[model samples]
Target chain A: MSTKSRKRMLPWFPGSGAFVDADTAVAAPDTLARVTEDQRLTNDGEVTVASPDTLARDTSEREFATEQWQEVIDRKLVDWGRNPQQLEYEELIPPTRFAIQSAAAIAMLCRDHALAPPMRVVPDGDGGIILERWKGSLSTSIEVARDGTVEVVVVEDCRVVSRQVLSLE
Target chain B: MTSGDGSEPIDKDEIVLRRIPATFEWYNPGLGKPIAWVAFKPNENDRSGISVWRRKYRPPCEVAARNAKPGRRYYVLGLRVALLRAIGITVEPSPLEGGPGHANLVNLSSDAYRRDKDGITQLAKIIAERLTICVDGPFGPFDIDARQE
Candidate 1:
């Protein structure tokens, strides 16, 4: 018998397709991206984890890793004289949820400006990826957008502090 | 005038009487080290002399005029004496010339203000008593006329 037929042939078993629903799976990609972004901020340019785990792993390891990354970002923010309290994670928003929101916000702003979609990529280290506008000649603020891209402005009068390619480990 | 010990009166240039503390150091070439000394500035115009307290094994001799830098020696002697007197030690004036003590007193008094850790009050008092300068206070006009060259 065929694989589907054999699965159906089992009397006590439910039908073959036992998978997560679309909304649950769709939410995961953005969640992973936010986690990735948070990791970037905390490592001080060091990339820690690759992809977010979808499985039920040890909670302790995850909590420790999150705390470490949060500390890194918190220190950087404090050093820059920015308040970390403003960046506190909301209960409804997963840490990675912000990445999707930011991306959408950027996209909306770019659309309003009649600009092309900016190339967005997660860089290796804690340093964030550069969102180059107008073919690298002009760059928008990392945490702020003057052109009304996003309301979540983490940086004001964004100035480029340093730029270099970080190695992925 | 002569003392009862038959020593002639210290001439204007012979007997040096610089008031100094009981202990100080003198540069001794024979021992290749600085020997403890004292100063004696006797007359107003006489050059002060420093007497090195030579070790018992070493030969005792008066430092020659040419070999001594009296101005520098007097200043040092004065400084040492001031420090000693601060702690209540009595210093005696020496009769010899051209030793470390004489140079110390002159050197110290001449530029006591410039030297670090030289107490102005103590220096003024020592200068007043030893050089016979009229010191009205720790800082005032005095008769001592040594100036930096």
Candidate 2:
């Protein structure tokens, strides 16, 4: 019986078609490319379980792996600022999920503007977020509060260009 | 932390150091490795330094720096420090510089990520062995001593 027919025969175990034979291999565009081009892919029992796409998927997750900046914003920015609240010491202000998201959003804006992203995203003393981009004596930053209010500051090569309050809401 | 004036040719010569929290997992960022680092003013208001990396820098560079205050406890990845210094970023000799006692004297920087418990434990032990911490009074730079256990 053909592999498809064999899989259909095993109706007792629903979704058993996921188990492809070892020798099975599909010679189409790799599965990952298919995923990138179209948000879905099918394992038609023809693609080998060890296809390049499968290998890529297994090696490194491609979920947030997009372009350089997006990948950095998604993977690095989100997790790098983890701080658990410390009521006892009053010194810890863990990066809130919202703050992390806001920082990344601002970084994405910088990328969209063809500007370099901030070198660091710091929490403001008053419960806000700051994205700092510094080169030499130049400093550019975007400050975001918990309420989604933003302040963008640009200092190019040491001259303060502009500091503006932006409203994303 | 020199805020340069526009006509001063924007000095690119200051060495900005990051105080790696003893347990911060800075190596976990999932993008291309950093090729260079940039300098930014330290937030004087951020007491914990936790917010310094509220989102973390997207570009690769050793962006970590010590706060102006001394004896403030922050962690550093030893690896990144050496790497930064190797590429000529002028990383401070001690991870906890000007902060408290022997914790600043010990080498806590490592190339590996902080998620490696074995690495952190080993480094912690090395730090603990060489320094005697005194938490009697309110913890600050004055609280720690060089007398090792």
Candidate 3:
């Protein structure tokens, strides 16, 4: 798609090029702008019929979240160069490509489940990533290991509420 | 003992250490695992304790530390600084900066891990004690019974 047309579509679809998958756009009407944008670019140039209500501004929140997450991945932890270790040691490990991919999946999961953005996105010392969210005294953390397993733990009032592991393999 | 500048020392005897949960609630790791410090005088109610936190560094959290390198040292330092700040030990530069005085506290913290085996643990103890003295709110330094760190 040309940049001009994409820019013109922004007001109606404030979240352009946000989702990589068109199927994701199908769930929310707010995404129709992007979906339409996609359809406009495709060879067929067609969108299957759907009720107008299902195509309204529903994914605004999700789009905003997707953008925020995208910003994190793009930086690739370069901003950490100013810290003490960066000064002393000379260099630090950047986030892995796999880690960024896992983050995207986790962000989509949060969107699908209506979960808020995490308070933190930590990269563990074990070649893994963590997403942490907090509400009052309640805290939830999801660990995405390089092995493709996800561990979710919810703590309330400093006590464990639930702990479960999901296999993404 | 007091420094020539007349400020009192950060007496180990004066600090009351407490054991709490392994993680800090107020810390936002996404903000680059920051190294920051805040200073305040309890009960003095003057302009001393109302200062904003001072950020020293913001190291990126690494994907893994299995292979310790020069870069990995940063992640450790950042966490130590965070832990120290969490427990109320100030890492901010002050008029007492430089020399072997109150400012040496910062120097000591910065160099301790490289100097001694028990350095990290000792620092954590100092921080825990300082935290016990300063943090009175519900947010904590809670879980105060662990005793070992």
Which number leads on lDDT?
3
Per-residue lDDT of candidate 2, residues B1-149 (tens digit): 22222112112232222233322222223322111111111222322221211102211122222221234333332223333233332222222422211111122222221233233323332222222111111112312331121
- Model 3's DockQ score: 0.05
**Could you tell me which 10 consecutive residues in candidate 3 chain B have the lowest summed lDDT?**
B35-44
lDDT of 3 by residue, B1-149 (tens): 22244144333333221111112222233342221111111111211221111212111121112122322221122123344455445543343332222122342332433354133333432332233223321222212231121
Q: lDDT score of model 1?
A: 0.25
Candidate 2 off by > 4 Å: A1-66, A80-90, A109-115, A122-126, A156-161, B1-149
What's the DockQ for every one of the candidates? 0.01, 0.03, 0.05
lDDT over C-alpha atoms for residue B41 of model 1? 15
For candidate 1, write residues B11-51 as lDDT tens digits: 22222232221111111223311211112212122222123
Which tens-of-lDDT digit does each residue in A2-82 have in candidate 3?
Answer: 322222111111112222222221223343354532332222333344345543443554455556555544443333222
Model 2 lDDT tens row, A1-169: 1122223110001111121111221112233343333233233434223466755653343322224457557655654444334201133334455666666775564343223334454454234565554544444456566555665555443344555555443
True contacts kept of 1: 0.00
What TM-score does prediction 3 earn?
Answer: 0.36
Q: Distance (Å) between predicted and true CA of A21, model 2?
A: 55
For model 1, the stretches where C-alpha displacement exceeds 4 angstroms are A1-95, A123-130, A134-138, A144-169, B1-149
Model 2 residue B119 CA deviation (Å) reads: 42
Candidate 3: stretches off by over 4 Å: A1-60, A76-101, A111-115, B1-149
For DockQ, the strongest prediction is 3
